[model samples]
Target: MERQVSNRYRLIEPLGEGGMGVVWRAYDELLDRTVAIKEVRYTGVGDDKRADLNRRTIREARAAGRLDHPSVIVIHDVVEEDGRPWIVMQLIRSRSLAEVIREHGPLPVAQAALIGGRVLDALRAAHATGVLHRDVKPENVLLADDGRVVLTDFGIASLEAEAGLTATGGLVGTPAYMPPERLNGEPARPESDLWSLGATLYAAVEGVPPFKRDSWAATVAAVLRDLPGQPVRAGVLGPVIMGLLQRDPAARMSADEAAHLLRAAASEPAPYGYAAPPAPPPGPAGSWSDMTGPGERGPAGTVSLRARRRGWFLGVPAAVLAVAALGTGGWYVVTTSQSATTPTPAPTSTSTPAPSRATASPTATPEASTTPTTPRLPAGWRRLANSAGQFSIGIPQGWQAKKSPTRDSITVTGPGTPGMLLVEWTVPDKPVADPARAWVELEKEIQAKGEFAGYERIGIRSTTYLGRPAADWEFTRQRGGTLIHVINRGFRTADGRHYALYWDTTDARWDQDRHYFDQFVKTFRPE
Candidate 1:
């Protein structure tokens, strides 16, 4: 007979056991779903102290329940039975980061950085709600099979609004990951949590904690008195890790700076001559393809536009010509005389003249000289400012600009040019989480529907631009019987605004004109 708790949760098996509790794989009869239940227990204490511990467990669990983030484990229910609290939580099918490192050795620097970023996101969310995760270590991080890096086990968390719960003289975190201030009997601050995060990222890439020692006492001493050895494998994450591990919390790196550096590290290109292992076959039990539903392969940091809106990027309609005739100073439009012959695609290589090459261009022209506020343009290049879109970019001499029909995007083209550059910013309701993954999903949808004629993919790579996560998608497709190469970069602003920069040229001129795309990206500035 299986043991039942609160007449709702049925214990299936013990998942793991630790000093404070035993986590069980339990079945929730009422919800008809699997859940994880942690049974809190106290030993070597008198009845009065045990009762106090029970109350603290319930309070902490309730405090943790207030947190809501994609990277945070959800707390479902907390109940007391037989003088102890049981915390019911979302059951994740995954292994802890500690287990992964132990079994597979150290992870790659980029992978470690990615995991660290997710954990930091969760920490920021919790901190915003006045909760501190007192125990943040490899054992508390869950790498879910569904490509989620989740922070779990908030059993020891503390609420800033509440008074201390721990007994008069007791520490409540793993020694190796604890900050120096915490060891010196100081209260845990947000920066203290950052220190632990740094230690966690170090262990993730080094296979050992920065302050690991032979015993608990030695580890505590090392954390409080000694400096950590430099991490050789940390790569771009080395400074971030060391900065967070500073003994003086006041001198540590700020969260914003850490986030920027982590994103940069996560987006670092693979080492030279390195090749990714082939993805496993789709039918495997734990394969990502098998876990996700059709067209839902996790956050790809990209959103799909409605089918009718697809033409905004591929073809310019008559409505755009009408917008040009209005002569609005903000509208980048081509002349009406050239509208008939111009294919006017949002931006790409086509036989027709580009919409931007008209004799009468918009008021926003290339910068004649540079100011401290304005980015300097290369020789023969000019800055084009779009007041309506609140963005500015550098374009080569003689390049013209045209506004899209929706007025949310702009296209620029040069005289007799076979290539065009487009800047778009029509973000949807939901923001993308992974830009590279979004491109992969988008590619599948387009290919399945045969949208692009003779389309072939080159690659979709993760990267960072403007200190934010971004991705670059490169491909080739047939346009008017001519092969054209295209690259589209998508990213979100710090304030959640999404943008994409697209450029295309005929295959014959791709090598010569590709530099324009790079220059455009380098000079783009969003107001």
Candidate 2:
């Protein structure tokens, strides 16, 4: 939008879209500078709730603003626009780690370890200040064009010693990258993040997350029960991945240990003629060695000058909050001493706990980069042809598809998932020639009814789908505990029947699960 918000930040162009909100490359009219503006378009909540969330967003921004580490993204200001909060931040021209993997394939082993180590440095600094970055995934890790591996999105972070906002028993975090304890709804410790870092590194080298599955529920089960498929590509770092991916949080590898392991695996020579520092002994002694400044060394080993100057990751894992529950939107995070509220989930299958899984068996075939750009069906997905011979679509195996004939739609539901895919068709009021405007009226209908709360129309635009004129509407809504992202696409066939496909995914799995919708569109055939 050319229209300015708060009389200062003017929207330039969308940099990215997510379940939370859209980030725009913006212009600051007052200062004549470029910045990134995040519009928090939360809808459906009451006035009081919105006000609380607004206050919390400001608090979170202030917390992040206090962090002066080089790897943390800087927050500039918080503004109120249209009764919602907007966060203005430093706009680093960068690509996410996820994007890098998608384009270049898996990184070389040493390079992956080095990146992971740098990220650990940032996390250590954040932990030192009592900030728990509750969400740590590849998407949150930014690889700046300038070689800066910055960690962004503390929107869902928990400040230690504060009341957590999440209701008891609610789940948080992206399931695939979450630690085992967090997946079971237990609190996440710093080691939990280390586990996520390990998973991220696993994906960095092996191409897919350690616990990926077709549905969120199964993914959660896998995280809790199954060991990640062994990684042949991990090479020297394979043992490190296994150490960090420990099923028991209490038994998980410490950040310093993991970092040291990464450094050893990195094996690149230090510019100042030193090797990676040894895993410090547990106590104040080793902690100081890690925090020592340029050219400092422990009594036994020499620390790198760069590591000393750059403040390398603390080998000792700091004890932070184990679990973070949100208040409304994830941006408003709260902390708890323990994350014991997660219900004990049933076993996934007959698989035993895989503490020694990587060493125990041969690696399974690795899944490719999970960026979800192509139309190919992932393994284990099934194709279903409509009984009426109208079309066929790919769906995750075991998901139940039910027809709602009166609504002219078919809905697919996973066993324990709230996400859904809906396909609907109806005879147009008359012979509709152009599909572009066919669904514009429906978009207007939704806009008028205020059907979406925190409703920001990402956009409603005309496009071509499979050589047929089509219109697509992308928008986000916040409903109670769930932040929902929706893609609604309408297609007009030559037979005068208008068909629409609607895909809904929760913010937690939005990036990972949206691919199925694409596969559906690719596989759809109009007969």
Candidate 3:
């Protein structure tokens, strides 16, 4: 905040602001390059306080610099000038995994596993160097634009351990993502990092924290005593969640085992691109390619230009939705077609104006466009509502919602596999708001009545429905190419509390009809 702090690093734009300090995208005149400068905010304290704070800052940077792993975000320098401490580090250009999953739902299994494995790898490196990350969450793990995972916010918490850096009794990490040991006041260690990683993976797959509460005290209670509703059964990840939530720190899986399991999970289909590099890193001759420069030869003496041009086609299925709205910005859709050959793009139309945010003109000046806006939806597609029964939400107009053959639910056919939408409404005489209890009963009921077996609950959260509170759950099962999307909303009417439940799948050529399905869910608000 002070101009010319130490008179060498010139502050530019602020990158991020946190309780401890403000991170600025700064220019280092001495180094003649751009770097991230973190300036500490000292409380109203005297000289003795400032010196102690500076010492801790140096210690953190020094400890982090000792780690020599690609997975860890590099910390370049730590400088103390005029009673304040500043840290210079590499600037990562990527959105946090937290931001990605927030815009979408849970990540596909591959991406989650890939991210989890890398975080564990980073943890191993930090522990090997006699240091703990102390904080591990989606926000701290960045998926760089270059498709690499970088662990950040290391050892910064230690700076706050000094009296001058932060106020006493301040919570240093994200609450829902904090491991139980951290809540219990135990010093962070390798096991603590494991716990945080587990929480992060859980949040990544479940689309929310494993343990959540509306109030702070309630959250603490949930973390200490509550069992999270089984997460969306992400095939192999189910067992991993069980291991991560172990109350006793010693009972949890080690970073080594977790990483190994993640690699194994990468083989299964879910969402997100977390698959390990191909047998030869997508290069020729079955060896890692050296596609380093603009015009250099890659593996097998092939021109690197070939690989660079083909990068967009790799692992990207056909029919991808790339749509932009005024206020909502961009959203993607992945759809599968009827022939099951070509993948359909997800619906990304921004036709419905965003009432919550401002909108820009359809065509902004090209010269003024520095950041590229996501493309608009293709012509002629219309959004519709999901009208199966009491479950009425928006959907694509032409897609058909038909009753399931089993007579228990209705399936809405879209253009692709990811495009199909299913809704089923079930009424229970006695309704319960707790997801764990509801899951146990629902599992038993589905097993007994539904045609499908092997049904498993993933994660559940308490949310409001139609102006009243309700519970939502995600499940995984053998749907014979059909993925069941179910929701149970409890409403108190003249007949007492009752539940509205439904299930759907993307088994059909789902992409043709996916835009409407996602929009239906996104706009679904009980009136």
Candidate 4:
């Protein structure tokens, strides 16, 4: 081991101790960042042991960073300091899903689904990137502050390591979360992960895994030969739980399919429990004490009946409670009439005035908001009268736009080397290239630009444009030799019509136009 290790990180207090490592709260000196540094001891063991440990540490770091999904914990860096290996991860101050369940028995079906969906999404990304998370237990899943599930701990995750890196014998995962295939020493696969996710969800909804026993061996036997108990019929997670627990991995649904179903279930009306923190208290128009206090007839902090009925945040059931208060922004805090277990104090005061408009008649849930039929320009994006819809934006005056013969839309370009803006329209029944294949093609385009340039491909996200089905894509590519990069956004409407836009410039120059990129995505309306 070397002295003091790297100058960048100052190791702080020990967070927790593990079988092979200890996690410390460390301050990153170089980046001025706070991160968790996990230190694994490398006693004067054989070279094989040291190599295996190093490989495990490096593999975990690579696997976690490879997944860009929000539901996966972010890995910052991995380093070997003074004869010991340490991996730094984002320091999240939230309870693990396992601890949360232990504190509050079983979670409601809706909450479980919300947490489950996010984990599955991360798994989808991991599998697509050729990593198998062999471990998917509750302890490894964190419940983020924003109410999202983040999967953690890939220390034993299988990856394409060199020949000397394999951990022989029982080097897999927790028995409860390990699928039968993995326990049998068979190769781990995506289906095995789905089985673990099912077990995690089962515990979330039923307060126990289908097979829990006093002895570890008994538990293993039960997992291999027995069926678990049924989850409470409190919500729509019933079928989903059963499907995930199927013994045959082939019978289990893929992570993507499971996520879609979970999202659909979360969208429906139900007796959902728990509260989402108020949307960052709209700039504090005034204090909760000043507005509605001790004894008020109409509940304070609630939205007007009209606004309540309008629904917000995935139609969160509490939105309809209607506790009216005065504020310029639309943030909600509970009144005395609401839950009695209020935790935090009311927000501060603000000067901005609330909008004065006739409340639109109550409509369907927010999720059912009208979809855009075609891309229409969003409010406030022009010198005057810009016709390209929200899905479109103005580029530097010299750039040009040309229609793609194969695609229904346009491809814009500028007077330069090999760079072009590609756009295409999609309609129902017409199949777009598979995402994996599209990524391959995009990789080719990226490699052609430069050897070390980086590119990010955001997933196909669903959004309503006006009142039709539409999806938006953002592709950011960096090129060599120039401090510039290219950004392209494409939209596909419900009817299968699609449009794509691109921008090419150095990063420093593009900073001036970065805000437009966000507004472009939000305001895109399909007419």
The candidate scoring highest on lDDT is: 1
Sum up the clashes in candidate 2. 16
Global Cα lDDT for candidate 4 = 0.50
**Models sorted by lDDT, best on top:** 1, 2, 3, 4
TM-score attained by model 1: 0.56
Q: What are the per-residue Cα lDDT tens digits for candidate 4 across 190-275?
A: 89889999889888878777778988898888888888677765367777777877888888776656766675554333332222
Taking every candidate in turn, the Cα RMSD to the unseen true structure, in Å, is: 17.3, 26.2, 21.4, 19.3
- State the lDDT at 428 in candidate 4: 12
- TM-score of every prediction relative to native: 0.56, 0.51, 0.51, 0.55
- Clashes found in each candidate (C-alpha, N, C closer than 3 A): 7, 16, 46, 32
Candidate 2 stretches with Cα past 4 Å from truth are 43-48, 168-170, 268-527
Q: For model 1, how does the per-residue alpha-carbon lDDT over 354-401 read when each residue is reduced to its tens digit?
A: 222112222222122122343456776666555444556777667767
Candidate 2 lDDT over residue span 1-527, tens digit each: 28798988888777777766778888888977678887776566678766766666667667777776546787888888788778888876556778767766786665576567667877887787777787788888876533345788877666665536533344547999988887666776688788888899999989889999999999989988898888988888898898889888878888878877776665432221111212112222101111122332222110000111221111110001011123432321100000111112111111111122112111222112122232444565655545322555666657766654212346767865567777654311112222333334444444565655665555554554544345565666776756887766664333222356777778687667776677667655543
| Alpha-carbon lDDT, every model | 0.65, 0.58, 0.50, 0.50
Query: What TM-score, to 2 decimals, does candidate 3 have?
Result: 0.51
Residue runs of model 3 more than 4 Å from their true location after superposition: 42-51, 157-171, 271-274, 277-527
Evaluate model 3: give its lDDT.
Answer: 0.50
- What C-alpha lDDT, on a 0 to 100 scale, does residue 351 get in candidate 3? 21
Candidate 3 C-alpha lDDT tens digits along 1-527: 64665677787777776666777876777867667777777676677766766676678777787776656777778888766778777765555777667766687665577577667767776776677777898878876533446788774544223334434344567768777777877665578778888889898878888888898878877888888778874668877776877778899886666766776674443332113211101111111112122232222100010111211222222111111111233221111100111112222222222111122121221111112223222233332222222223343434455553212234555554443444432211111223223434444443565534455555443433333333444444554444544333222211111223333344243234434544554433221
